[model samples]
Target: MKAVIRITLKNGVLDPQGKAISHALDALGFKGVEEVRQGKLIEIELNENDETRAKQQITEMCEKLLANTVIENYEFELTPVVSS
Candidate 1:
């Protein structure tokens, strides 16, 4: 199984990195770039074949270590890995 986790800051949380990127873009003449929010993408390959179980495991991983639940939110997508 293949899983992709996306971790991002929640609303109202201060994102200094995102702010810096936005400012840098404006300086580089990337006009009309109103806002920027930075996030993380994690890709994992699991041995588990069951989609439901894989999702559950990934969710737990996110809750325990992949994300800071206090200021961040995480979402994931699961896909079957085809053997070639």
Candidate 2:
């Protein structure tokens, strides 16, 4: 089983890094660079099979170690890849 976690800042949070990226893009003449936000993606491999339990555990992991919940929000998806 593989889990992909995406951590992003909640709306109304100030993202200085994203703003810097946007400014750089504008300096490069990229059109329509309306907005940008930075986030973190984490991939984990596990042996768990139960989707519900696995999601719960992973969400706990995110809350504990993966993300700082003070200003960010995180979501995770579990992918089960069958071996042929």
Candidate 3:
């Protein structure tokens, strides 16, 4: 099974990296670049056969290691792999 997790900052959190990028864009003459935000994607490939178990484990992993639940939000998608 493969799990894809996307982590993003929560709304109302200040994103300094995004702000710096936005400023650079404006300096380079890029117009209409009002806002920018940064996020992370984590893709994990596991050999588990049980899809439900893998999904549960992935969620735990996200909470423990992949994201900070205090200021960030995370979501994951589980995909089953078919072997030939």
Q: For all the candidates, what are their Cα RMSDs to the real structure?
A: 0.6, 1.2, 1.4
Predicted candidate 2 versus true structure: per-residue lDDT over 24-43, tens digit per residue: 99999998989999999999
Tens-digit per-residue lDDT, 1-84, candidate 1: 999999999999999999999999999999999879999999999999999899999999999999999999999899999989
List of clashing residue pairs for candidate 2: none
lDDT of 2: 0.92
Residue 54 of model 3 has an lDDT of 98
Write down the lDDT that model 1 would get.
0.95
User: Against the correct fold, how does model 3 do in TM-score?
Assistant: 0.90
RMSD of 3: 1.4
Q: Which segments of model 3 are wrong by more than 4 Å?
A: 82-84
All models: lDDT?
A: 0.95, 0.92, 0.92
Q: Among these predicted structures, which one has the highest lDDT?
A: 1
- Candidate 3, residue 72: the lDDT equals 99
Candidate 1 differs from the real structure by a C-alpha RMSD in angstroms, to one decimal, of 0.6
